[model samples]
Target: MGAIICAASLVTYTSVSAEEAYTLTIKDHRFEPAQLSIKAETPVTLIVKNLDASPEEFESKPLRIEKIIPANSEANFTIRALKAGRYKFVGEFHEDSAKGELIAE
Candidate 1:
């Protein structure tokens, strides 16, 4: 009985620590849903999908993330828990047109 109880408790803890996921799409050299909001102090999984025929680099200074997504492909990134604030990101290949912000509240 004690062993079963411990197993249940472990399952609950594992579920609680799992980060929520969000998706962003790159189309026409721009990030769809240019702005996103998430819970503060909670880790998150960011999935970026590139629909364009060319590759794009997801770059963010404040978030300290950088990745190059291939054309018509997708990539996943793990973002640590964050404070209540806004973090800006851009596509290094198309800085002028590809811009977005992540808002934590």
Candidate 2:
């Protein structure tokens, strides 16, 4: 009985630690819902979906994240817990139009 209880506790803890996911869509070289807000000091999963016919690079200097999302595909990124602040991101392929920021508070 004790062993079973311990296993259940471990599963609960694992689920709690799992990162919460948020999604952003790219269409017409722009990010839909260009601003995102999340809780600070919590792990997060950012899913970027590209709905355009051309590839785009998702980059954030503060988050130290850079990846290429293929045309009409999606990419997932795991972000570490962050402090309360704003992190800016842009698509290298369309810097003028593809812009967004992550607000953690």
Output the number of the TM-score-best candidate.
1
lDDT of 2 by residue, 46-67 (tens): 9999999999999999999999
- Reference-based lDDT, residue 96, model 2: 99
Q: Write the per-residue lDDT of candidate 1 for residues 34-105, one digit (tens) a residue.
A: 999988899999999999999999999999999999999999989999999999999999999999999999
Clashing pairs in 1: none
True-structure RMSD, every candidate = 1.0, 1.1
Off by over 4 Å in 2: none
Model 2, position 89, has a per-residue lDDT of 98
